[model samples]
Target: MQSTQLSPRYRGLRLTALAAVASMLAACGSGGDDNGNGGKPNTKPAYIGAVTISSYDGATDDLLTAGLGKDGLASSTAPLPLNPAAPTAAELRRYAIYTNYRAIVDTSAGGGYGSLYGPNVDAQGNITASEGKVAGVEYVAYSDDGSGQQNVTMLVQIPTTFNTTQPCLITATSSGSRGVYGAIGTGEWGLKRGCAVAYTDKGTGAAPHDLDTDTVALIDGTRTTRAAAGKNAHFAAPAGATSLAEFTAANPHRLAFKHAHSQRNPEKDWGKFTLQAVEFALWAINDRFGAVSANGTRQRTLDQDKVLVIASSVSNGGGAAVAAAEQDAGGLIDGVAVAEPNLNMPPNTGIVVRRGAAQVAASGLTLYDYTTTANLLQHCAGRATALTQAPFYTNPTMAPFFAARCQTLAEKGLVTGANTDQQSASALQALRAAGWEAESDDLHPSLAAFDVAAAISVTYANAYARASVTDRLCGYSFAATLTDLKPAAIAPAPLASMYATGNGIPPQAPVQLINDRDPQHGPYLNLPSVSASTQRADINYDGASCLRNLLTGSDAAALALQAGQGLTLRNGNLRGKPALIVHGRSDALLPVNHTSRPYLGLNRQQEGVTSKLSYVEVENAQHFDAFIGVVPGYSNRYVPLHVYLNRALDAVYDNLTAGRALPPSQVVRTTPRGGTFNTPAPALLPSNVPPFAATPAPGNAITVTANTVQVPD
Candidate 1:
């Protein structure tokens, strides 16, 4: 769980956001004039400016250029002589937000967060977002919140066709910048698909979308075109939702949220600002995208087409609350899905925080608070020990919708009472205070014992062991004799744990070259100067980012597809759509254990709603690499990314005219790992060759695991 950032879903937003212009129409503006009954209703929603606007679809090139020039005050026609610095109605209409980055190295002899690989990240490029043909610009925007905070940013091409009836998703700055990451938006999956995208600075990259990426001067009157932030008043959490922390900063409207990662964290003064964006989105969509009123007190009603809610979860706390509010609003969201949301976990490891509806909520536990498992361990332990329980809002369940999948996780070995990192963090303290720990079988588990989330966060170069255990592979071992042991033929094998092996789904290929231990590549980066913590920041830390949003398989994906205007078919049996679950077998961070059940449960929850759910095990893949390398469909470019692109686009076009829901029944297949060893590999003695010789191979394998990492730590 190394706080996986919300990338795939962030990409999911691009598809959904295609309809931003149509969906964000200001339903009806209140004239504030007394109607037949004191407070009267007006004609259409009151127009905001002197000239009425049908929508912000970049109708004129002048408007686009205005926001970029004229000393930040590029005044435009209508709308109060627009200040280009502010997010334009069109820019906002076509905006896409997420964590995206290109690797950048601190070349000053010896400095921060070492290099990506042996070569400095800068040497690689100023940007590495993804390899698609789409153009992108990066920047850093400074907000005069009067807080002395300077914001860095990155903007990318978030193209949208006019009047296309589609759903759109949004994310806060989970990564520092360059999209959601840094350098450039090269690591993204959507840009490859040409989705119009936008982002804040995840790192020191150029600002493509920002009106003021290169200079101190912002778009003049930029503040004017922007929506003023809500006051920093204290607000209570809703009934079912949890109240995580409080802050003094006003909520970050969509524009402000674009700069969320610009300032460093661990300080309230360093508040996250996107929560407001979430609330505004809820209000905007319900009011126009679907058929709902803008007033917070009105009933929610969506179009027959389902709408999806997606977030990065990195700076997702505020966004989570907004999503919850929208889902609860009744009809706005047919399905609510977040990538990795932790609405109220003790994030920041140990940073004690106040509850602020205005401040953005980061996704994971921090150095100040507990880690993922530890936070959950506290929750579970709290349930077991407390005589009087707090209400859901008060005791406040974080990620309850998703956490409910815990039972499924327990069925697999993904979740264990004792080994959870959080449980381990509190081990000794619990023992000393409560007489004994909570697990039915204590094992007097180490308070800091290796928990799946914590372990995976630090590095994929881990050895899964139970103390003194010398070797561990997902679920395979090297053959005593290498019959197919040729160097060119080596491949990864599927895992075979009892539950994972037997669970119904797609059958997976067995690893060709079974190894005696886990892959190790940390040292290969050639920077003894870097540590796991540093690695976590540059490439790991997803705890806070992904927590902003997540929705598990089937139902979640279905919701996303609907929002994006994709298709689904109902299988005959009437069971939930069966999914061919796929994950990296040797994955160290979000270990296969934690992933299995939630995946299986998704299939179950959609039972009677879908049909024929299944699972597949990718032998040696990591997280994000699935689509990048191979594994078409699930992670492959063939299935969903490219092969399915035109089909998905067609689906969007069809939905705009007719009210046709997606096909409920479907079949999905996850690709096998890149290599396919015919049999197995011969054991190699610590040869006379350099130890580093075999190391790069493991590093190559590490990319798959980087799929959902959180923003720059």
Candidate 2:
């Protein structure tokens, strides 16, 4: 570990600068006013709204585990609200932490929860009996303009153990369209390391607008009517072409998610929101720990120059970290460490990605491009005879729909085959040709079975297109469904608790993805809804095709979506910050071929030798560690990717704080915890997931020369 003390020379200079600023403020009559009558006007960023501050004791109400502690977090069942219909903000915060923590981590002890990485596991990788709670002060606010449309949630958690002398900050942007607590598991690393962790939803969260009741979620996860919530509402459906009442009456029981219906193309601002969160964190730290003059004015105790800030997270949040690094004009970020980031590489980068001896057929595609393609073909691909042995392949309920999807693809000439098996094989081949690696094949069945592709495609299409909920883009709407699969009123309990439980994307329990264009069933759950043209329950193939068309089509809406995608592209520059990205080669959701691999290549191209980015490709690891414990086959085949993320963060922190060298870009061939498919695998051992080698063997090294990235088999 590095010493948390500044060099004497640097400290002297910083103090001199602070004294000069203090003198100037005093001369201007703004030096000593704690009541906001003066004193430099509360240096809070203009973008940040009113802040809510709360304190917690490590034992009962704490920051990291939300008082659940390590044991409670690892438990299968999460604590629920006493009053489900109206959960208090405190209860919702606890529930959000529990759900979001478990959502990304493999909590089972057999999966390495206790031994490898959990609250009980200390920063040094030693197992301890402690519950791992940290006393802290939390600051929450909305990063929004006056309209309140872009109420991106910002939160800062400063632990009592935080080292103010050698201050460190980590950004934990919310992952997977989840709420503010979405990356709580990732934030644990920084919290345990005595760093203040800054979090932001990046303008996308679990806040849903119940259009029927005109109710919206607030920043604290409490519900109120849109009219009453006013500017504090997390999200409310904007006035569309038709009045709110008329639209609600026409499309009753529908819900509008902030990510999909905010009409802000929030993904474009993810990097900005992440930076804003850091800004908020700085402000909070200064306000809490700054020096107080005799006149009671708070003076700056920490600034960007004095703090070691690392932009870090996983999945979408990881992408945001990278973006923040690229857009960091103020030199706020010192380093970056992320895992399986969903990065969007700019088109026509002239960067080539090669794995083993073969050049990849496709690289650097946008999220919607591949996600929409997966949505269209994955179900059909799941029917391939080769994938029959894949995990979650024996689904009696969805097997018929998979077959129907194959038939539909064959009829549309999207796939060529005389039989369902052949067409399914062709669809699977299409995915591989379009950038998905062969390692992703086994996970397709499970992802498609869980409606992962469809849910993401629908949500992202609307988000990128900036479509209003009233548009029902691609014939899809979010709503509660009856047992009969018909659209129904969203239950009060689910709606109220959605901020804690619902991922922004629909098909989240009661909030199902509704296919409004289902001619036969008339607004039903997308899984069983019939396509009008084919009159078959082909898992809403028509809607999937429409979303895919948005990527390839030249129509007005498609053009709008394409334009929105343009706004989310990363420039591939980390501004010379030392960064490490670890990605699972088997990640089905955000394939490395389109994400980390290409981004690495692009970064090298953009920065040349000045780039300090290292990419670690981990084999036998897939996205979604949460699936490892409960999802039968996952336990046997995949090690927790979360462990690698922690290792990456540790390496980056050491590099930034102690001037250590980062591990060379390499492929880490992880061994899976192989065992029976349905039973829990043997306990995860350190040998299964090795630490990064200081000098990787030639075969494992990932090399980048000029604009090309080459990975060994």
Candidate 3:
């Protein structure tokens, strides 16, 4: 899931097909919008607002982008300490940032943001339109940086009939990457189960552009501090590719790592934007639509006080949801739900540390430095001799290239000697230089495999640079190979954009801080440090200068804040709310260890909160197959967990309103459907792995005492 696969731009065909099916099923289920409420409904009044809502699109003119801040100026407070080991509840409150919010949509006008629901369907696929209706509305949140407001679209679905006559439960959902659109893509079966479900496109939906990259620019800002970095300085375009994702994949520049940490603090943080969207939706349901009832009197659409929010995302979205809800010290949301969340920005640091690759690069340390070793070693061994070996050396197109590099290594005694990290770096430098300069724009799909070679080679080179120079001079080398280190084969952009997100708080565990030098990266530093490696590298730079600049500023105080914030919630600061954490046991992208343990511990340790948290694991699942469309036969043929998730939502609602204990967690077992061209042959998992079991973590669960929680040292 971490590796590049297909871009979202390529999902058009699949999305269209799925949409058609969903539409037909919805139409068949809904009883033609006629027999819904107490009587035949009439057209609603026009929305009285400063901006007019339009159909959702990527461009500004095609979307709604008007709204005034109800609370005036945004918060300008300094942020919490970068990575507090344990933050008090008061500290969290002090640093809790918010955007001036209000319901920008005039729901009383017309059809209320338009309906996206098809006729609702029963288990028998029977039409039941009168059961529920899904409506989408657009609103704007004032930017904290005083930038023009950001437009957010929300989808609200209310069951036509509820078990209780008072009103349906108000439940809002947030996803990590796809935005409001993705929240609905998972099927509305849960929305049909007697609740008003609301979701939003994190501010990125304001204009027509890729939500992920546009967001990167929004946070990083367009003004380039270094003119020498060039036109695409902040985010260099890949060779000739205009698309952002393509540029990132084709040229994995060092600056790309900075994208995750580039998100602005205070208002423009995407997480705050997402949470505000949910908050605004809840407000609209209560203050806007609920203000003018069906008969015109003030009657609510759903029980305003009984709001429960849930989140499930491929990466950071899940964590953002929890952070938002936690920061909502107003107690707006009653509960929380999370899927495999990206709790850490430069993820997999522990593994990198354990593997002796968390080296402090002269250019500044980075998780990518670790990945450069981990991924490459996973594919090719650490032998300089491997260069002359069969797989790569024998390929007709690659043989000549390998033969030349092997010769260079032989001349330097790098291949036949101990193959030290320095030697590995030098040998790789020779090979990569020849390959990148081949003058072939025609990239092969196998480039990803080649990328492994490049990454591994750089790991050694980075290690050498770290050791040979002082901490300030650490960075990318001047060699052309180190400068232009992309693979010859092209790859699609990574499935999800990495983000720096968290529920504002300290980490529950001791993370590998910027100064924490692992065995592989060399001696640790006792004080705050800066890297001057970028300055030296740029002087002799032959590669992408944009990426090169990130090396020097890699450990900047702001960068540390961005990376640290992404993992804040992983330390078990749940704010004493009932919660559920679900993860796929086989999720290659976000390991379960990263999401489940600390969260479960925090809740379980809290006396009254223990029963409020539940953790579930799905067996034989990958990250994507569980959410969006299936990947055919490579893993699960289909993800059948919506019913289970709905069940979790029900448990959450019960715990919130009725004071009932949450259901025990369990392993949701799955069977592999391996056959067609789309499907790979299914293999059984190892016995050591648990098969979707949620029996709480062993040992005493982590407990938060007086709002200050402890983490693993």
Candidate 4:
């Protein structure tokens, strides 16, 4: 998660870096009332003046499109007037509470994270670094909060050459502070093919230490520690509803949970923050085009219409891309490329997350609803032990049982031989103590032993594994040779014990006692009041209600947004634009179904234009693996998923501009290492399988006219 900075690949283009020009200060005034509540404006509105290009060497306008000459390129509009009524820039700026603008040139040594890759890759997948320029333009904007000013900086990169014969594409990377730089570096590959890239800070990417606090301020206006954070906050059990206490009472063997990750923003402002970043880039395109056109650097202008918003995420940011597009409704977005996107669906809406109102009433683990067997399974060995320890696994009964089971497994030789029982117990005790001792102690070190012990215990505890004696747990068993259970055609198949354990909730776990719960956690959850097989499934609306009570004075809109209904900057709906979605079948953060569910929902509602959307489930892929490279030095079992994703993006561009028929929805098959994909691949598993079958079938490719789903085997 590197900061969004332009790679040194732009060294060649810096000679033309814009020079500093005398900036004219516009008188400050409250732009307008943007609260939408129809109330008087609370704070002074932000003022935005005409963007001034401080320096322009104009060494070569080859990067400029030929339609508009580079000379005299200036903003089509004048500096927004100081009057309170001027709302264009003011309205946009309100989304981000920045109040100041400064003009300056930031030159990097042309080195950073981008240097790790062999060479810059072009959009066409060619390895080259010839025509790109990375330059920083200090964009200073003051916050009306009186916190002074914040630098809403942007890194602008352009290929020194352009396919001037056609409109040049401008790609904006708004992947946030840590991710923006990496995305820019990746997007710079497009520079070889005459694309311009802009990276803008959404003012939301705060340092880790500040992330929670900053996010709280940005969205909720401030952060508050709930007094009842660790206390049971659920209400009295509702009649006919299965409460947590009831479930536990019925199954005393269930684990008692200690709730955590409780910090939540009652204000759903991250969506607006992301949208603001996109808007800033749009503004920059106009500003740069105007600067180049005014300076007469080239005879053409960059294609504004051809601009596209590209975002790839395995976390909240993943949802942001779709949210932004849906909110903008193709107004600012033409197409979207999302990989394992974590769309902002409200809690308790899906099978994996729902809890009865009364069930929720009896627990402090509202956020803990996100943890499931499938998700925790992704945390292997050392990582896996974290699931059993304190905050995450505070299940009082289960924790000791899991720990004892791990000890028994070590004694029985059913566990990995990497550690003895004494060693594993020693490590486990240390981990548990750390949970009770310090919050910041890195628990990852003790996890491997913990997971090893837990794996053995969990396996032995599960009735399904009663007949097995196992070797070391492996994570790659999903792609393993069925005959020998060895890594199939891939080097260094990491142990697949995790995959072998299966994704079912283990026996003795409280999840097993629940009849209506999906072992795969997500926004979807069946109300305990209803049977799991009942078609009357609904999200736990009470999750939002509970959160509202926790954050007294919080606007209900935030909860609604989280619940997947309130209006926000991003609507999550695609407006009949060419779109490509890729999700890893094994994504731990956001399951593969997240992608399919949204596609089907839109197909049902949009009533047509199914051809506009293409979804691919990459076999054996994980949530982040498709976009972010494999974790550090680990040998990846799956192909470089991004290679396929970039190709999909290329197809999206063609569908948008050339009227080419988009590819059908299909599964992206993986070949052995070093294999190349000449065509879109099919799935290793059919849709009739458990996860897919659990939901309505979405057939192979979506039918455009009928808006019907087709899931081809």
Clashes of each: 142, 0, 31, 69
Least accurate 10 contiguous residues by lDDT in model 1: 247-256
Greater TM-score among 1 and 2 belongs to 2
Tell me the tens digit of each residue's lDDT in model 2 across 154-182: 99998988766567889999999999999
Residue-level error in angstroms, candidate 3, position 335? 1.8
Show the lowest summed lDDT stretch of 10 residues, model 2. 24-33
Off by over 4 Å in 4: 1-118, 128-155, 162-179, 206-267, 291-316, 346-572, 626-636, 674-713
Cα-based lDDT for every prediction: 0.23, 0.87, 0.32, 0.31
Model 1 alpha-carbon miss at residue 573, Å: 25
**C-alpha displacement of 248 in model 3, angstroms?**
17
What does the lDDT read for residue 541 in candidate 1? Answer: 18
lDDT per residue for candidate 4 within 1-713, as digits (tens), equals 10123212122223332311100111121122223223221221242222222222223322221111111111122232243222332222311111110000001111101222212333444435433232222222322122222223333444434332232343433332222232432343344445444443333222111111111111111112222211111101111234434533432222211000111221134344445554444444334332222322221122234344444332344455566556664365556665555553333332221111111111111111222221122122222343333222323423333343333334434344343334344443433331211121123222222232222222212111111111101110012222222212211111111111112122111121121232233212112111122222111112212222322224432232234223222232566555667765544334333334444434334434333566666655543332212122111223334444555566555555554555656665544221222222222222212121112234433232232233333
Candidate 4 — what's its lDDT? 0.31
Determine which window of 10 residues in candidate 3 has minimal summed lDDT: 503-512
lDDT of 1 by residue, 21-49 (tens): 43464344221211222221222112111
* lDDT tens readout by residue for model 3, 40-159: 222221211122222222121111111111111121233333434233322321221111010101111011111211123342334453322323333322223222223233444433
Task: Report model 4's TM-score to 2 decimal places.
Answer: 0.45
TM-score, one value per model: 0.30, 0.95, 0.46, 0.45
Two-way lDDT contest, 1 vs 2, winner: 2
